[model samples]
Target: MASSTPQSVERALAMFDAVADAPGPVGAKELARRVGCSLSTAYHLLGALTARGHLTRTAQGYVPGPRVPALHRGYQRHLGVGAGVGELLVRLRRATGAQAYYTVYRGGLITVVDSTAPVSDTAEPFVPGPEIRAHATAHGKALLAGLPRPVRRRYLDEHGMARFTDRTITAADRFEAELARVRGQGFAVSVGEADPAYTCLAVALPGPRGDGSVHALSVSLATAEFRGRRGAIRGAVARAAAELVPEG
Candidate 1:
C-alpha cells in the first residue's frame, strides 16, 4: 500500500473548504485557482467529493450538498469550543436534569456545537450538531438576537424567513418582536415543536464590541419537566451563559 502525499491531502482539504464556504455555487476553474491547485488536481478532488455526496453539480456550477454540512458538523467538533461545550452541557444537564445544548452561529445559520441529556432516552431528540433553523430554536434565536444590528439585518435579508412549525416566528415584524424580548429578558425560550415536545432556554455568549458572537448555551427538557422546573432552569441557564462569556 502506498502512502498518500501530504501535499495532496492538504490541497484536497483546501478545495473542500473553499467549496463549502463559497457564497454560492462555484465553478471548477475558480475553485482550482482559489485552492492553489492545478486544474486537473482540483477536478479530481471535486469529483471525489461529489462522489462522496459532499458536492453536487447544478446548472450554474458545483454547490455543496448535505455532505458538506455533515463534514462541517464533524469539523466543528475539533474547534476549541467543542471540548469546552461538552463539559458545560454535561454540567448543565446535571444541574437541570434536562438536555443541554450549545450552538454557534455561522454565516447567520446556527450550528450545534455540542449537547447532552440527563437521561439516555431512545427519543431521537434533534441529535447534536448539524445546521438548525435559526428562528425555531432557542439557542439560535438567543445568539442571533445578540448579534450586531447590521449583521442581523444582512442575515435576515439573505435567509429570509422559513417556517419550521406553526409556532415559528416567520413574519419579520413578529420575529423582531421576539428578538426584542430576548434582548430584554437576556435569554430565549422555545415551546413545543419549535423544537418538539421540548422546552428550551438559551442565552448568548458575549463577543467583542458587544457585536455578539454566534454562540449560546441552551437547556431543554420535556415540556412537563420544564414547566415544573422553569424557575430553577432559567437561573441555571443564565448562570451558565455568564460563565461562558469572556470577562472584560
Candidate 2:
C-alpha cells in the first residue's frame, strides 16, 4: 500500500475548509480561488468529497451533507454531556424562567454545549454558535476565571479583549479585577456586555479531577428581568452548578 503525500492531504483539507467557511453553497470556481488551486483540481476534489458523503452538490453548488450532521452528533455524544444534562438545562430554564446554558472551556475555547429555552410564547430560545465572544459572556468569564492565574494572563495577552458593546470590558486590568471578583463570589455576571438586551449569570463547575478543562452553567434573561432578580438568579445558578457535580 502506498502512503498519501502531505501536499495532497493539505490541499484536500484546504478545499474542505473553504467549503465549510462559505456562507452558502459555493461554486467550483469560487472554491478554486479560495483554495488557490486550479478549477479542475477543485472540481475533482469536490466530486470525491461529495461521493464520500462529506459534501452534497446541488444546482446551486455544494453544501454540507448528512455525514456532517452525523459526525457532529457523534462528537456531541463523545463529549459525554448527554440527555441528562439537557434535562437539567430544561429544569433550570423552567425554574428561572430564562434561557439556561451549559458551556465548557477546553483548548482555550469556550463553547456552549447545551441550552434550554423557548418554554413559552413570550420567551426567545437561546441559540449557541461559534460567534460567541468569550471575554463578554458570563459563562466565558466564569470559565476564564476558573483558570490558573498564569494561564489566564497568557490567554488575555494572546486574545486582547476586543470590545463588543459599550459595556464590554476592554481594559486588561479592569477585566482582571472582574475575574478576581468572579473567583471570590463563585460566579460571574454580565450585564449588556455581549449584547445590550440580555443579561447573564454563570457559575463554574469543576472539570475532570486532573484536567485543566473548565465548565460553566449560565442563565440569560432580559436585562429588565435580570436587574430585578439578580440575586435570585445568582443563587439559583450557583445551586444548579453544585447539583451538577458528580458524586464520588
Candidate 3:
C-alpha cells in the first residue's frame, strides 16, 4: 500500500516516525541513518517537515513540533479512549507493583496508547505504536482473544506470527490453542515470551466500543517476581479495569 505513495513522501513520513519514537532529540545524521536516506535527502525532508510544523530543529537536535500534540489530541478525540486511562494506569501500577499499560486494537493493529509514567530515570517508558509479535505479549493476546475467530485468523494470516523470544509461540496450531486458553481463563499471561526477562498479565475491557476497537490493560514485572504474585497482580488489573468507561 505504501508503494503507491511517492518515495519522498514515504521517506518523509518514515523520518517523522523515527523522530517521534526516539527517546529524545535526534540529530539529522542519526535520523538520516535511521531512516536509510542520504544526508541531503534527510535535510530536505526535515526542512519540509519543519516548514509543515511536524518537527522542530533545536541546538542539540530535532524534536517534535507543536503540531504533534494537536494531532495527538485529534487522534484521542477520534478514538474516544485514553481519557482517564492515564490515571487508571498509575493506580494499576501502584496496586500491581509493576508497570501498567493501556492498549487498544483498532484498524487491524494493536497500539499502546498510555502507560504509567516511570518513577525513576532508569525505569523504561512504553512507546505508543503498532509493532510485531502479538502472540508474544499479554496485552496483544488479550485484545486478539476478544476478536471474532475469522478476524483473528485474518490478522494471523497477514502477520504470520513471528517469534521474539525462546518462549514465543510461532506455530499456528499452538498459538490458536493459547488464545483459546486465554479466552477460557478470562486473561492473557506471558512468561518472558516477548523479552525473556519480564512477565505480563492483561485483561480486556468489557464489551464493545462505538469505534469498534478492542481495549485492554496489562502489567509487567520481573518474571521471577510475577511468578510468585500472579494472583495479586491479576486481581489488581481486573479491579482497575472495572473503572474504565467504554466510549459510546
- lDDT per residue for candidate 1 within 65-159, as digits (tens), equals 67766665566644436446677778888899878887777655667766674335557465565555767778878878987778888887877
User: Model 3 over residues 151-196: C-alpha lDDT tens digits?
Assistant: 8889888887888788989988898899999999999999988888
Give per-model TM-scores: 0.64, 0.78, 0.88
Q: How much lDDT does each candidate structure score?
A: 0.75, 0.78, 0.85
Using TM-score as the yardstick, the better of models 1 and 3 is 3
Question: After superposing candidate 1, which stretches have Cα over 4 Å from the reference?
Answer: 1-82, 117-122, 209-212
**Worst 10-residue stretch by lDDT in candidate 3?**
118-127
RMSD, every candidate, angstroms: 10.5, 5.1, 2.6
Query: Which candidate gets the maximum TM-score versus the true structure?
Result: 3
Distance from true location, Cα of 223 in model 1, Å: 1.4
- What lDDT tens digits, residue by residue, belong to model 2 across residues 100-136? 9988776666678777754343444345544257789
Predict model 1's lDDT versus the native: 0.75
| Of 1 and 2, the candidate ranking higher by TM-score | 2
